[model samples]
Target: MEYTLDMAVLAILIAFCVNIVLCPVFIPFLTKIKFGQNIREDGPNSHLKKAGTPTMGGIIIIISFIISSFFFLQDNFEAKLVVFSTLGFGLIGFLDDYIKVVQKRNLGLRAYQKIILQFAVSIAMIYFIVQYGDYEKMHIPFTDKMLDLGGLYIPFLLFIIIGTANAVNLTDGLDGLASGVTALVSTFFIFVSWAVGSGTLPVAGAATGSLLGFLLFNAHPAKVFMGDTGSLALGGFVVSMAIILKLPLFLPIIGLIYVVEVLSVIIQVGYFKATKGKRFFRMAPIHHHFELKGMEETRIVTLFYVITAILCLVGYLGTAGIF
Candidate 1:
């Protein structure tokens, strides 16, 4: 499994093309199945018009990634781990989407149920990473040193995997928001992974391409929503790449959008409880707050993209040991 730069770019291009092809076919099929999105009643009023749009388009992304990265799959632990984590989380998301669309449950999986499944996958991944991962040293940003967490590695990894997965899930509220942000993050990962000679480059490249292709229909006035299916799978893919590349520490920098999106919810909830029903932002997840404040959805999304790109640049510099 010798990798070349051409192969990496090819993987991305193949995934992008495959996704472009699949979306047309899959979106129609999803619509035929009546797998439409159930917009939150409490969400922005503008989203009500998207009610019947096909959801669960993440299947397209997963299929494209698997197909594009297939030729680059190595017969080794890293490759297997990446695939396993992605599919495992994707399965969880698929089930959630199924319950929502088919069963007509607005809340697909119970919070407990979702957490249980996520924990199961996270624990399994952490176990395999400990036993088979090539390195136990986590990189410390802006320095030439690596830190060994030693005994705390398992819990730390669990926190990262689950937190990242859910953070991405939270960021999926708006059309193309999650997919767009993730594409940029995945692009960052591709370069970082390649720099480290990691086996995860193909997967990262495929992710970037698939997300971009998905954006064709996922952007403003989305023809289809990715639902939980795509969001959780993307979270899994992102965290796994970071873990394998020993760049989990760089996630808060590179994935600043995910971190802030999650934190906004946390802060809003805590503030509301403490203030006895007083609100913090106009909405949680911050993006919604901007929308509530009269910013256009496209504008907010672009702002996030710009911030994420800058943060990714910072991460790249840190990874290159440029302080």
Candidate 2:
């Protein structure tokens, strides 16, 4: 069957409805099972009250998107690759969240263990892309140029997968922050994928719709958190679709918020050590810095949303060779 705009729209609506219906059932069940959030004591003071809000809400997005997207994956190998890549990373995240919330392990997966798992998943994705796809050349944004990695494609793609996934994870600090920002980014992907006649449109559409539905509960004064489960899976979903669409380079433009979030942490860490315990921002991730600087969480999140939308337009222009 030929894919159309209507099919994409239907996919979005299906995922949205599924997620909307699932949240009420999932949140209370999580609460009953004591799968609550643990606010970092070193973080913002206001967030302490968010403690005990049900966590691991990413499962809702995963289930919703997969169910809605399954129809479009009938014979599309690329779409299957994107969807399963998302599920793979989501399983890793689920494991982490399970360790922390269920087993009461405050640190969740150890640093080395998490890295090993992420590496394994990323490698698996690269192997599939190499064996089954033409993903060697990356489009340079705002130009009609393709940079082929050739022998280095494996490492380059690996970095894109791991870096983007973790960058998105860092952006999950505030309620509605990661989910809202990612929803906008995925919507941009839907448009671009449609413009290019890419098969990944359904995955992007499902992501956009599922995240928007998730926002109803994730917005400021959130009823629950997506935790690492949602954030990492979102990262995986975002990067995988980009890779499949051959638009990986557009990430820094469309995902600028995630880049900044990761940079803030890096700058904060590097500066703190260099200054002999002095700090750069009042906090890392920059969102918490603004929170410390007296910005309301809702306002900051809204600002990020608007910025992401604008960046998406810029990304579209670049992708279309209009800029």
Candidate 3:
């Protein structure tokens, strides 16, 4: 256990050092390539000035994880699968970002197109886990019970991979919001992995370190945006990590902020259509509602960070004795 923790820590330091060194040179290069994010016209008015910031920063993040995986998780088959699935999702996000930025269009890949790609990736990942990885049962949180999904696990896994990948995407609105929350969630994954001596520790550590480094420039009054590339990659990696640990059922509890963000958008959209455009929150994503209610972006981000920490604690407690 101690050795695994030490290894996780080493992976984190390596990822952070690599990412920090890459950011300064990377941001300028992105600017030169004109790979700037297109701010949605309908978004918060205060974000107007942030238009054209360098986006697609997920490239560096994925690079860091690739490097981290080779160094710290080379022998772990499950970890490799998680890392590769994340890379696959990163590619999808990269295509989406490319269309939006390079193509100079607000709408990137059409929604169905992205979903189809996501489903393809999800199915591939689920097949790998079921065929290669040993765990086929989910550990019920807060109980000494297991539920075998049998063949149904395929669809269940698909729902989780797609839902969580997009859920984190929706939470990317405010500066540092997605990165900070993801960093915290990744940190929780490290603890959980450590508690069980799981092979997932290295990738989780890599994720934590990369997101923390990204947040240096992504915080309030940001200089760059993560775009879909970062968010979806994050969503992919996070959900994969949870599934790799066989804790997919606990993902919503561990990542409640993401759940709320997605739910808020769904509810807002459904209600708007039902009521013929009568609104609930000032915006779809819940974070935007607080923003419209006069909460500073930094404050909203900070509060979400705190909430994520507490939820992770609950999740950790619930699963502590399972291993």
How many residue pairs clash (N, CA or C atoms closer than 3 angstroms) in each of the candidate models, in the order given?
Answer: 0, 0, 0
Return the TM-score for candidate 3, rounded to 2 decimals.
0.97
Model 1 agreement with the true structure over 224-266: per-residue lDDT tens digits: 9998899999999989988998888999999999999999999
Candidate structures ordered by lDDT, highest first: 2, 1, 3
For residues 1-323, could you state the per-residue lDDT of candidate 2 as single tens digits?
56567878998999999999999999999999999998889999999999999999999989998998998998887788888888888988999999999999989999999899999999999989889988788888988788787888888898999999999999998889999999999998888778777788888888988999999999988998998899999999999988987888899999999999999999999999999999999999999999999999989999999999999999988886522
Shift in Å, residue 262, candidate 2: 0.6
**Which run of 10 residues does model 3 get worst, by summed lDDT?**
1-10
Predicted candidate 3 versus true structure: per-residue lDDT over 1-323, tens digit per residue: 23388888888888888888889989999999989877767778888888878999888888877787788665787788878788888889999999989887678999899989998999889878878897778889998787798888888888989999999989999999999999988998898888888888888988888888888888888777888888999999999888888898898898999999999999999999999989888997999899888888889999999999999999988785486
Please give me the total number of clashing residue pairs in predicted model 2.
Answer: 0
Q: CA lDDT, every prediction?
A: 0.89, 0.90, 0.87
Candidate 1 wrong stretches, greater than 4 Å = none
Candidate 2: the clashing residue pairs are: none
TM-score of 2: 0.97
Model 1 lowest lDDT segment of ten: 1-10
